[model samples]
Target: MAECVACKQSSMAQYTIHNVRFFDFNPKAIHCMSYDDATSRLALSRTNGDIEIWNCWSRPFMQLFLPGDNDSSVEAMVWCQGRLFSAGLHGFLLEHNLASREVTLRTPITGGPTWCLALSKDKKKLAAGTERGYVCIFDVVDSGVMYDRALEKQEGRILHIAWHISGDYIVTGSVNCVRVWSLKEGRVARCGLGAADRKDEVIVWCVGILDDMTLVSGDSSGRVCFWNAELGTVTHSVHTHKADILALTVCPDQKSVYVAGVDPTIVQVSRVETGTKKGKVEMWVKGIQRSIHTHDVRALVVTATDRVYSGGVDTILTLSYFPPRTVCKFPALPPLGSISVAREAESLLLQYSDHVELWRLGASSKKGGKSGTFLPVTKDRVKLLELQGKDDEVIQWCAVSPKARWIAYLVQGSLRIYHFTPPASGKQPRVQRVKEVSQEIKKSHQMLWLSEGKLVSAAVTGAIQVINVSGSKAELEKELTLSPGHSVLQMTCDLEGKMLAVVDSKNIITIFDIEKETISVLPGHSSPCTAVGIHPLTKEVVAVYADMSIKEYDPSKQCYTAFCRQHLNEPSSELAKKHSVILRVSFDPDRPDLILLHNESAFVVVQKDKMAADVSQEKAPKVKKVTSGSSPGKGAKAGIGAKFSVIRRPNQVLLFSQMKGEAVVSVELNPLQVMDRLPSPLKVKKYGGT
Candidate 1:
């Protein structure tokens, strides 16, 4: 309900778009990360103690999450023998259970406030560096991590630690110097970093060990130094960054080293063999550098296959491939939006990590401004309800009923429902928990509310649960179990919740009739279905495939609509499929022939009108026409192919919801606004520039 930009679109009801630009969903910064090559899984810990398990096989999909405590924080994380472990300033080692999405074991370290965590090459021991300047070692046992002993104490805090592959020595980076400890003899071999002067102490943030026993360290002085572990002398050093280097990683081939930090650039150092006066000498030199981030990069990892994964204070996960020069930026946001809107009541539900809030949509200026102008606000948004979660579990999904009479949210494996009564004039609203939910409903992974007071949910096994909720009672109505092997990839429902469309992993579309308790399959397609929607008026199910082709199904007729057949067979429609992956499909109630499909980047409004079924202009307002041809050689003409218009906006849309009065609201967050809230990035002096 923040002050939004109001845009008037030419369509059947002259719809207005509430381009909301005040959605505040700031993600936490990444502190550290670890990768397991065996399973291709990544364990990333945020500034908060929360840990996220990401599947890195084909893509970075966040599979499981372990919520953190209020007073806790994670400083470092490491993966050990397929087991995920984290240590933080809380001074305890944590073992996470992926199945339960919780911490299974917590063992305190011998020293105070662990600052760094490193796994040994043998995968049998873990070393924890502490703020008290001690390196504590632990044995990885079947029971859990058990404290073994502590290394010799140093003067400064142990900011970083790295274990050599030989297991005979370990390297530690501290305030003013880097030290190499001989584990076999239990003593320090190297005691200095060759600092020109000790007046201004340099803070070492990260260190790594290469296969050739070269100690790599990045410090506050913007230097990447390679040290000879045995001689404790610097071999080569380079000023690769403008600020402190917070992260460093060595490739498995021992040929490339990546260093990044406050400067937000990843500088690659490659091993080069130079023919010197004496003989061929192996040397390290700075190579290609990519400015991939906008803020400090705190974590970097190079997998066995040479894939680079990096994250930092900007809350962005970047995947990089060197030779191909391929870099993809993945936002840290979850799949679904944390915000939901109640169309009828005009109320918004905001979901946070530990709580949920209900806010009233504000009023806009009667005289709307231009498309991009910030319309004047008539009323400020007001807060109505704040419901704290029962426990410290991340709220996966939350929704408010169409009329704002109910609210449902999923936390962990539990689905909680509450009766939300809108506030009357001069009176406060009320929220009461609707208890005794069916066990099947509690296990649901997603939830939706129909206008007629019915709740639809999908379980982990792709099963459907329909529950009748009213006042303070929730009764199980029906449960439809899907086939054992089919996994649901996308799900959607109509206004009345009668038609539920589910797309499986195999690109099959299944429509369920909630009232009749029946199911039907639509004609299959070659490309996979990316999104689906149920028409509110005509009750036709719409499916959009990976190739950007679309289809309309008559659920009642159990066949494809004639209009859909034409769209699929037309060769001119190839332009529709070449955009980004469409994630959501929104229908226009007034113009049933038009559908709005959107990804995170842009909106696509596809007008699928049959040549014979075209409505007269007197009956409905004419839609804005697109004159551009779909393809290069195709001529622009009406009633020839599927005509679609693409609208690219400036902000990223977090939520898009349809209302009753032919109006739609798109909650967007500005990129500049997001950066304004982040910690100030390093400002480097340019050559003759402001």
Candidate 2:
């Protein structure tokens, strides 16, 4: 028995990705990544304006997802102090607090999209490079900007920025040269140009500071150049890659630099001391034969003395270790429409473009012949249930019950509910179709489970339907009708499941009292409403409109008491304009004062009362005042102070957010807190379940 158990344990450890606890939607390219040694967290920015934070040391590997600007791509990200600062194509800088899980807009940069960012060692200075050949510097304190400075322009777009460890100098790489700026003097301290004889001028894409007086830069011509920053002269240059060098990370000892770019290869450059010259060191390339990445490497970080992490277009995070040189890789989930975790069952519910699949983890055993012994084995992924349909039948939305017994999914404007039961022994779980309801509405946009046997669905036709599933067959219990020409765009329910808030095509908000069978419309928006959310504890309804306006409705008064408006300037590109509509509005589950407002170009979080004071008319609503406390009889607000949200993004973006907060029922999940605290495999009994 001991031998069999040991063999099984060995096989599981060898095949499983123990370090990779959480995975996001696959296929979306990773644009940038940063590692904070202090927090032991890895932050990744993807092409779809989604940010993912992973705690490397946490058990079950905690992950957090912060939603980005709708349709906007994140250009750069960096971790400094206790905050994650990110820049995107919208030209705004975002500061995300690791502790509070709150995001705030720092400032907007001029010239154009900020491509690269760097923070000084003292955490007081920040430097950003813009696409229009300008470098901007800011005095940062507690993730807020104190002052700003725009340095002199160079020849081309600034691609990369690196600050000196001493906090006095910054090096920026641009089209044809590398320039070092002195923050104390606010001027160019030194500049090094590329070779003038070459036919094509080299574009500097990445820069790394080796020391206070030394700088290393990589260019499009694949040349790595070492320069003496104090003297403004190149000391050595070597060809490193086949094409542009996109990322570079310097070792903690300052002895070697790891480089990766357009090519799949990762090369290490070390400065070797020469015996003949006492003060001179020659640069040599130590190449790794195995390709660690399948696509262009866009980001690199040195996590420790011997460990490095790299991610890129391939959507894979690779960990490379030195000395003996070992590598481990983690791949994201295959590009899916949506993903949800059934925490109690240790199962993953995934929605693909054409099908829905439930994956479960369980223990299996194999008999060792002639020994009369059974070896305990573990199945990493077992497809317990799969639901597939025709190509045109796409799943629009899905929801799982709290007990993991009922699953509801919407396909082609119809709703389907299934009852799931795990097998008694080693058979596949049975997924029995319990209910199917067809609707004549144009499109069913959203669905939510009010209870295990009850569901509420909203359609674009301004109709809301309540279905009951407790009687073996699904039946339409209540159908609520709205005013003509008003199409429901977004809908949300209160924590108690008694009040439903709906945003309509005409920019109106309708609050429905489920128990009383009454509806009230709150008047205050100028443009069409896009998203709506209800506060769990206070029963406040917040709505966002296409004109970038936010309003909070007081349920007791049936009026808008507070409002906030976001003033977005004219868009720079056609793509930006196409996605300019307001996408979502939500309140922080823990803090009712904090509200998240998202548009196509940016995600802005503001304090509700403060925002009201800033942009709203406090006396606009003439209604009776009511106490802002939790009510007594209404099922004690189901998810009070629970960290979650319902704002939906693209498939990949939503999946990333769901994976981070797998244990919570929120629109957005906080990475700092999650409920997936499964015991370590080593602590489980030999034949026990995961």
Candidate 3:
């Protein structure tokens, strides 16, 4: 626990918290990562071939997640011209369509089982280093990949590949040497690595290139070796690690380099200038280093966001800054918005790469328990149904109807609807798939269920389509136009599902009327809105932005509504400024004036009753930061007041739901649980140590 803070909720002391720590979030190790500076987006692949595109601006948000199946795997990935390209042991070159959220192309690799991928400086040529020691180059044109040529075959597998700034040469690391391949002359030079006595001691695992034709290689010998590839000579070699090096990333400035490996520590090597100004001696010097990961790091990337990110078998994504304020860890929980709650049925729908699980929440006899103790179960939680997609399909969106009778999900532009009935006593729940869903509603961005068996979908055509889902059929009812050429990213509705609030990609927030077929575009913000929620009591929309700013808009009046004029001052608070992108904003039905906002870590509770009023001019409200719980709890809506308390979750929160019970559900990913399933970690047994 962190600390205790003052809260505005007088009833929070009695609130029942269903801290669910049993949900199995089987996270896979990160295998590769690629970053796009233009979009500030990072694309990473897991051991299961699942790929997630994270918006790595103010926060690393999992904007898009593409799940993988049993036969899929990814070893390397590259982002080229706003598109994502990945390769793996499957021997296929995959180019994914971000708009369609699917694999648009899968070209087989002739080199067999690609181990790495690199893009040319011009972003026109794509290269894949494969198991058969062949470098295959392809042409990337207009969102497509076309095979071009394969370089002369070498002796060993190409484990890593990197391109020169001029795009004239490609550098590859293999079994015991690093080779530089000239586009015209094939393999121009090679620098052998490792000691003569050890065969596989110097396995080159990762490689990079400098502008001056200098080749950098990280190998199994725990060394960061610099090679003059043009002349096949070793320029310098530094043993920066005590174990094998696995990942290396060059800073944008090219003056600094970050390398990490089995030692689990990130080492910063900088180009330092020594001696006098007239005769300066430049060398790469070992600078300050930080140890964040507890296991080997396989993927490392440094972005202009001033944050260096690394991930590996530990399944934790760590972000560290240079001077170090605090190291933030994005736990390997299913993407934040992936858990959908069915309040009426007291159930939850958890989204995975290839499947969706519907679990009926359990109840305890008591309301609250000790901080570290588990409550006695009155009713056992049940996994009602696990709906899995086909081999060729990847689940994109999933939702459970408010009543939990209808479960709908989208897989690669194909929609599937299921009718579910919660079991009675010991009876099994009935699950039936609707075969006659409307064909026209297949290509939608997001889908949610409203009241009266009405399903609303945000179509790719920038229209909200209403569908009537009956016992075994679903039909399109009406299509209301939203913002043209813009896609809706998130959608929320009131308890009755009457008032719909949606935030689009263009940073616009719009309220759509279902029965009236009308649209009210709220005065939107300039920054990207991360979440939007409607207060069930007041029907007011609360929008949270990337900069940690909050706004409340009234749809009926088409105007901004706020008690305190200093509401914008919330982001200026030290607590709010440190938070990540606000993923969700929830309103308590009983306390509509209280808005509950949370990102990846902390929960901000705002109460309007104690709002700071501007008698002459509004002053900034007082801020409270707490790690430990005192009398306060997690049930707060949005408000601007002196009781603006930020409650930081002690562990990485997985899912928090407000259901029918007087309880708050807290699910967290326990690292020990994951470690139990993994093999024994590599360890040096200190005398008598466990």
Candidate 4:
């Protein structure tokens, strides 16, 4: 923990990196992320016109696909009722329905691109800021637009907006100024143009409304400003990030504010009572530190449960915990090109453009490091293989078998499978293409191993083909065809390998039962289906659609139920709709109920019973809830109906729990600690001398 000189009078809160999640899609940049307090879901918007939603506790649940040819990057998104209202580069507010999986409505608004958005506390009003310096306010009811008004213009694009908790005012950040708008008057109430001493025009990148009504704004100048929301004057300002501050969030307690941005640092600003003035409080930088993200931090949301979630340019999602002050990292996915993870071999195979590289994870060292130091030592990394392709052709997708003995990749609309030979005594292993098979399938998009000898593939021609590889020959076994215009997007097989779930371009989930040799089409989505997964325990099919909706289809019942509807209250319906389409769903190997959903931006972990309540009622063991205060904003509602609690541990800490007079102990070892214990030549160098 780094101490802030200005916060000497205040006590700092310890924060650690809890978890990091990496995205599969290579986004140019992550624009923003919004958290729904009602459903505990997080929505992420990217530069590629993609919006994704994740169950706050689980992986990605859905993604929203643009409805028309005018696909523009989403700039700002807000949730209302059961729909997501997004304004972006297309200059139109798109209303996406989570239940129906469709763009229910689209309305043209002022400005070429809407940059920021905020929803009122009561969920009735919405405010959007645009590239043309206009602030648009709208009345939302029953997931439909009632009316909209564009306020008087500012000078530059509106980059950030936050509605006051009271729902009477909205604070907006734009080029060179921060302004407060009155909801009742429908006009600007107050405006602060930053420090008069500053000569350069500062672009405000993020804003947050605190509990005490003070407005916090982070700008490109790397300064965080605190203003009196009503008076519209700068109360205090502090230099925070080294680069642009892109993300900001107010803690539910209202006592602290979290900020992150272009720099890798995350700063926590807290309000402390002034010693000289008994009743007055001042903002202080209580904690400042860096996380594992290697790039610009773009989006942040402090959930109602008090956990801080951050998404960054590195394509990773990091969770920061408070009491333990620990950080955890989750990587979204392998880069967009071609990549495959061999869990059993502990290796990663990646293809960038025309070059392929294989990386192996080294075994953990038995050594230990100094008690309180974190050093960046290169872990055992070995580049085992490199394959170069023709300059014009690139690997589009790739997959490795469970044991990593067989490798398959797609290039130039052709699928190729190769046998990987392990290195023998004093000899290096090599890869050899089996045999050239006739191209019976046209335009292959994705391929995966169904078994050690079987491969499943989806193509643009709306066909799912299963191929059998015996020794050196490849033979097509079966081909399943969808409707003429529907193309396969993603596919996954059940744990038993008897069933396969396929999501197609037409937003339908098709389940192929191997035993019956029959296909059952589950139709409910309104947009294209991105991903599908079969529950390991119950074998129910959970499908994520482009309109940001997640549904579970029970083949036995022949019925579909909204996955997240029962877990969240009515207010969260709007949040459920604001998520992007879910690109993938994965079940934990050890826990069948634990599912991970991911898209381009972030991934979340959710339990089956909590999300798919219609499927089962076997509840997870409940833990004691902890609270900071009796007030609702405090810890009163934190994780109110949550199924899981976050636990953080230090590198050397041991936790002991007592249940019914029985003690259970768990020990955790940090990866760095293991590396430090190793007698490696790299550890002999001085700390700062290169």
- Winning model by TM-score: 3
- Backbone clash total for model 1 is 1
**Which ten residues in a row are the worst by lDDT in model 3?**
1-10
* lDDT of each residue in 455-574, candidate 2, tens digit only: 787654557888777645777788888787665544667656788987654546889988899888887544555567777668887775544445667878776663422411222121
Q: Write the per-residue lDDT of candidate 4 for residues 1-690, one digit (tens) a residue.
A: 110010000011111111111111233445677777676567776565555665543433333322122255677777665467787777878886543334668887777688788888888888888888888888887747765788888778888898888887788888788888887887888888866787887888888887677889999988888888777888888887778888888888888888887776788877776755566656566565656566678888888778888876665567777677667665443322245555456555665545666655333222232211222323544566766777666566677765566777776558777887767698998888768564674556577777676778776555788888767777788887777777665677865567888766455778888668888888664445556788766777877554545666777666664454455322223224323344456554545555555433323345445445433544434434333221111222222124422221222221111101111111122334333432322122348887
lDDT score, candidate 1, position 252: 91
Question: What TM-score number comes out for model 3?
Answer: 0.88
lDDT tens string, model 1, 69-182? Answer: 676688888887778888887889988755434567999887779999888999998998998888888999988988888888888789999999987778899987889888
Error of 3 at 235 (Å): 1.7
What lDDT score goes with residue 5 in model 1?
48
TM-score of each: 0.77, 0.51, 0.88, 0.53
Minimal lDDT window, size 10, model 4:
1-10
Error of 3 at 353 (Å): 5.7
lDDT of each: 0.75, 0.61, 0.74, 0.61
Model 3 score (lDDT): 0.74
CA deviation > 4 Å runs, candidate 2: 1-26, 58-62, 97-102, 277-290, 334-337, 340-398, 402-690
